[model samples]
Target: CSSTRKVPSTEGKVAFNFIQINDVYEIAPLEGGKTGGMARVAYISKKLKSENPNSFLVMAGDFLSPSVYNSLKVEGQRVRGKQMVEAMNAAGTDIAIFGNHEFDIAENELQQRINEASFTWVSSNAFHKKGNSQQAFAKTDRPVSEPLPPYFFRDIKSVDGMQVRVGFFGIVLPFNKANYVIYTDPLETAERLYNTIKDSCDLVVAITHQSMEDDIRLAERLPNLALIMGGHEHDMRKQLVGNVWILKAHANARTVFITNVVYDRGSKKIEVMPKLLEVSEKIPSDSLTQVVVDKWNRISSENFASIGFDASAIVLEKGEPLDGRESEVRSRSTNLTRLVVKAMEWAAPEADLAIVNSGSIRVDDILTAPVTQYDFLRTLPFGGGLVEVEMKGALLRRILTSGEENRGIGGFLQYSEKISGNRDKGWDINGLPIQDSVSYRVVLTDFLLTGGEANLNYLTETNPLIT
Candidate 1:
C-alpha cells in the first residue's frame, strides 16, 4: 500500500512539501484497525517536516459531521465535531477549508469548533448569513473575533537561502445549503482570487470540496494554478487539466498524497511531483496524538456501555466485505443496505416491507469480517427508530417513484428484497402487483416519516393517505 519515489535533488531549487488528506471522518484506525488513524498521519507529518522544514499538512474539507463521535453526548452537550478538531490539532494540520458537511451542526456549534482549531482556514465562495446580511465566517473564540480570509499566503525559505511565496484559496460546493450559509459561484470566485494573488506569489494552489468534474472545470478556467487538492469523493483520483494537477486522497485517511514542489530561480519555472502513501500498520502512530485519539475512544466506549452495548463486541463474522461506501449505497442497493432494511423488517414483523434512506449509512468504507457494535454505530450514526405505518398503495408508489428519481443522493431509498420494479415496469409488493385501493403495511425510519428526506415531504405522518 506504500510507493517509493525519488525527488530530484533540491540543489539550487526552492523546494517545499505538502501532506494532503481529505474527506476524513474517523480519527482512529478503521476497518478493524487495518488502516487510517490521525495519530499515524501525525507520525507521517512529523517525518515529512524533518525531511523538509517547509512541509505543510493540508486538509481539503468534510471532517466535521457524519461521524459516530459527533452523535455522542459529552458533558451534557452534543460532541458535534469537537473530537475531530482536537484530533486534527494534534495531527499538525496547517490549513483547511469548510466542507458542506461542516454546516451540518448548528451555527453556534460550528463557530465553537472553528474557534478551537489552531490552523488557518480559507474560503473564497462560502459566507455566513445573518437575517438579510452576509459576511465572512469568523472565529469568535478570541476576544477580538478573526474573520476567515478568502485566501492566504505562506512564504518559505529553501535550505540555501532561496525564498518562494505560495498562495492558497479554498471553495466548497453549495450542496448543503444551510440557512446560515450563502454560496457564491465557485469558478468565478476562484478566478477572481487567482488574479488578485498571482503577481505576489511564486505559485498558487487551490483547496476545494467539490466534484471531480467541477475541479476539472476550475483547472481549465485557471490554467495557471500549480495544484488542486480536492475532496467530496471518497476514492483517490489524480488527473491533469492543461498545466495544473488535481489530486484527491481516499476518505478516512486510508491513503494520502505527498506533493513536492521545486521552484527554479533562474528559469522561473515550477515543477510539481506527487506520491501516494497508504496509512497502514507499517506506519507507527505518534505517541502524543494517540493519547488524544485514545481519550475520545474511551469516551465513546463509556457512552455505548451506558446504553447496554459493548462497543468492541463482535456482532457478525461474514467472509464477504460489506459495502457501505457512499457512492454505492446512494446509487444502488448493496449487501449493507439490504442488511439494514432486513433488520428493520425483523423489528416490525407485521410490516409487509421496510425502507431506509441511504444517507443513514454513513460509513464510506468496505467493512471486513468480525464487524463490531462500533462498526454498526459508525454506519448508522444518526440513529432513528423504525415506524410501522399503513398507507394506500397509491401513496406507496409515489414514494418509491420519488426515491427512484433521487438516485445518486443520500435520499435514495434502500428497501426490503420483497419489493421490486422500476417506474416504467411498475412496483410489486411480494409477488403481486400493487393496487391503488389496497392498504399496505410498511416499516420506515422515523426521519422519512417526519418528511426530512429530500423530495418526499408528502410522505409525512400528517398525509391523508397514511393512517
Candidate 2:
C-alpha cells in the first residue's frame, strides 16, 4: 500500500539519497586498528541523513543467524531478536529485507524479530505453508504459533514535493531451506510484487538477500525493479545490470553504499549513481550503537564462556599460515581450523573426520591475548553448526578428487585417519583416487553440507547427521 503520494511540481528539482548495507551479524566492536563496526555504520548513516534531508537508510540482510548473541539468547526469546531491532532502530534503518540466514530459526522466532523491529520487514518470496500438512511435511519446521504479515510497501516523499512512491519487496535466499524451511522462486516472487506495485508506485525497489546472480537475473526479468540490493556472496559490488542497478556490500558491516538516483518525471525513468563508502577506518563508531553491541557481547561472553582458552604459544602462533603440507599449524589446515576440528571431535564423538571451510575461518591472525569469548566467536563467526554424513571410502576419494580438480583448498576432506590412502603422502588419500562405493562417516559444517560456496556433490548423497 502507498503511504503517501505527491504530485510533481514544475517549479524546482528535489534531491534524495538512499543508503544500503548488509550482513552485520551483531553489534561488534572494531578490534585492532580496523573500524566500521555497527556503531560506525550508525555514525555514518546518521551523518549522511543529517547532511541530506531526503535520505533513507536500508540494509540488505543477514542481521540474524551466525550471531552468538542471537543464537544463545534470541532464538526462542524476544530479547534475542529485540537486540537487533533496537540496534537497527538506533541506526535508523528505514527498511530491512530478510537474508537467507534469517530463516535459521523457526518461523515464530522470525516473526518475533519482525515484531520487535520498528522498521519495515519486506519479503516478496516467503509465504505461509498452503496445506494443513505442509508444516508437518516440512524438513525444518519449528511449529510457529503465529504468522507474520506480507512484505512492506513504503511511499518515498521527494524533496521537490513530487510524490514518488517507492515499493520495497524483500526476498531471502531460496537454498537456505536446508537447515530451515522457507520456499520461493525469487524471480517469480519479485515479478508478482512488481506487477502489483508497478502502476501504483513511481519506483519499485527489490531489496533482496539472494545471490548476486539471482538479483541480476531478477533485474533483467522485471524491468520495473529500480534497484536490486543484495548480499550472501559477501562481495562489495555495484553495477547497472540491464535496467536495474544492483548494489551489494561485503559481509559484517565493512562498507555502506550511498546510492543517489534521479527519477526523470518526463521520461518516467530511474538513474542511479551509486557510491560504495568503506566504513572501516574512515568513520567513527556511534556511541549509542556501541552500547547495544556491548550489551550483546557481555551476554555472549557469559553464555559461551567454556569455549574461551588462552594460547600459551605451544599449540599455535599468531599470523602463521597453515597449509596442507606444513605442520606449522598442523599441515594445510590453519591452526584455527585444527582447533575447530578439535572442538568438533569433542562435540561429536562418533564422527571419524571433521571438515571445515577455510572461508568460515575469518580471522586473519592467530589467537592471542588472554582469549575472551569474543575471540572464539570471531574465529568461527559464521555460526555454522556441524553436520555428519556417511559416505563410501571410494566416494570420499571421488569427493577429494573433485575438490582437487576444482582446486578447493578448504572443502577437501581433512581426515582424522587415512581413510582413502595415506596422509603422509602429501594428504592424497588414494593413488586410485575417489571411488563410488566404500562407505565412510564424514563430518562437516552445515554451510558446506548444503553446498554453500564450495561445490561438494558428495553431501547430497549422504544422510545428514543432524538437522
Candidate 3:
C-alpha cells in the first residue's frame, strides 16, 4: 500500500494532493446517469491516494440537506442526510466543513450526522447556540461529547523524507439563521485562526462556504495563503487573488477540483496547480462506495413507494435539456423556470400572475429527457406548496424590485409569461403598467409569504398592503 511506503529526502521539498468537491447533494449519477456520482468521486480519490500517500479528499460543505433523500423517512425516522454521511464514509472523505444548508435539518439531526461522520470537521466561525452562550458543535458517538475543532492539521512526509505540517480552517456563510446556530464574523474568525495556527504549520488552507466576493476578500486579507476551496456557488470557478488561489467546483459532484501543491522548504515558497475534473460516466465508480449509494437508492425508492409515488415513473421527456443550472435560473428566466411558474398559475387560476424564487429550484443540473418523479423530487426538495396572495400593486412592485436586484443570487424571481419589464423601463403585467391602486392576486411559494426571502422581509401576509 502507498501508506506503507518509506520516505526519502528530496532536497528540502514536499508535495501533496487535495481532491476537493463542494456543495454536493446527490449520491447517484444525475442527468440520465451520465454525470455526477459520489462513487465516481471515490474512484478518483482512491486512485490519487494510491499514486500519492499524502492525498486528501476534502468536501467544502453543503452535502447534508436540500436532497431528495433528506426528505424521505425510513423506519419512521427522517433520513436527513444519513445517506450522504454513509456514502462519504465509504468514499474515504478525509476532511469537511459546514455549509449554510447544513443547518437546514433540525439541530438534533445535524448533530446525529456529525456523530456518524468518520471525517474530521473544521469550523472557525460557526458555533452551537446554548442559550446565551456559544459552543462548538460536538460529536456524541463517544461516552463524552467531543467538540469539533476550530482547525485541523496533519503531518505529512514526502517519499524524499521532507516533513511538512498542513493546517486547515473552515468558515460558512451566515445565510441560514437556524435557531441553534450562532455565526461570528467569518473574516475575523479566519484571521484569528490563521494567526493561531500559522506558526505551527508550514502551510495553511481555507475551506469556505460563502460567496466569491467573500472568498476574494479572504484571499486579499491573507495574501500569504496558498489556496481557498470554496462552496455555495453551483458553478466551477478559479481565481488568483494576489498569490492565493480560490477554487470552487460545480455542485452535486458533477465536477471536482484537484489541487497539486509543491512546497520548497529552503525558500519557503509554495506552488499550487488546480485542475477541474468532470465526474462523468467515463470515470468508473468505486465498487465499495457504489454499494453504499445503491443501498440509499433502494431506500429512496422504497420511501417514494410508501408515499404513493413511483420513483422511476417518467414525468416528462424533452429532447432538449431543461436549463435549471443555478447560474442560469437565478440570473435570467429559463424554460424550466417558466414551466414552473406556469404550473403555479394553472394551480391558482384566479391569480393574476405567478412568481417563484430561483432558490426554490435546487437541482443545479441541466436535466436531460426522461425526467423521472425522482428528478422532480430532487429539483424541489423543500417541497413547499403554492400560495395565492392579494396585495396592492405598490407592494408588488417593491417585491419585484427586490427580486430584480437579487440577480445572481437565490432571491431572484422567475415570473410567469404574463409578467415582464425591467427596472429602468418599469414592470408590467400583461402589457399594462402596474397601477398602485390596483390589488393584484399573485401566486407564489408559501415560504415567500413568511418574508423569509432575501431583502423582502416586508412582504409577509401581515403587512397592511397584503391580505
Q: What order do candidates take by lDDT, descending? A: 3, 1, 2
| Candidate 2 positional error at 184, Å | 2.7
- Write model 1 residue lDDT over 304-411, tens digit each, in one string: 898898999988876789999887998999999999998898899999999899888889877888888898999998766888999999999999999999887778
Q: What count of clashes does model 2 give?
A: 14
TM-score for each model: 0.89, 0.76, 0.97
Question: What is the lDDT of every predicted structure here?
Answer: 0.89, 0.62, 0.89
Find the 10 residues in a row with the least total lDDT in model 1: 1-10
For residues 1-467, write the lDDT of model 3, one tens digit per residue.
01223333357877788999998889999888899999999999999988887788999999998888877898888999999999999999999999998999999999999999999998889999989999999998899988988987788776666678888899998988899999999999999999998998888999999999999999999998879999988888899999999999999999999999988889989989999999999999999999999999998898899889899998886677788889899999988888788888889999999989999999888778888888778888988688888999999899899999999988999887877887788889989999898999999999899888889889897999986
Cα misplacement distance, residue 213 of candidate 2 (Å): 1.6
Candidate 3 clashing pairs, residues 3+ apart or interchain: 8-159, 8-160, 8-161, 9-160
Which candidate ranks first by TM-score, i.e. highest?
Answer: 3
lDDT of 2 by residue, 84-202 (tens): 77788878888777776676667667655666676656666665454442332111324654333245455555556565666677887675554435466788877887787678767
Candidate that beats the other on lDDT, 2 or 3, i.e. the better one: 3
Q: Which candidate, 1 or 3, would have the higher lDDT against the true structure?
A: 3
> RMSD of each candidate?
4.3, 6.5, 2.1
Please give the distance, in angstroms, between residue 24's alpha carbon in candidate 2 and its true position after superposition. Answer: 1.7
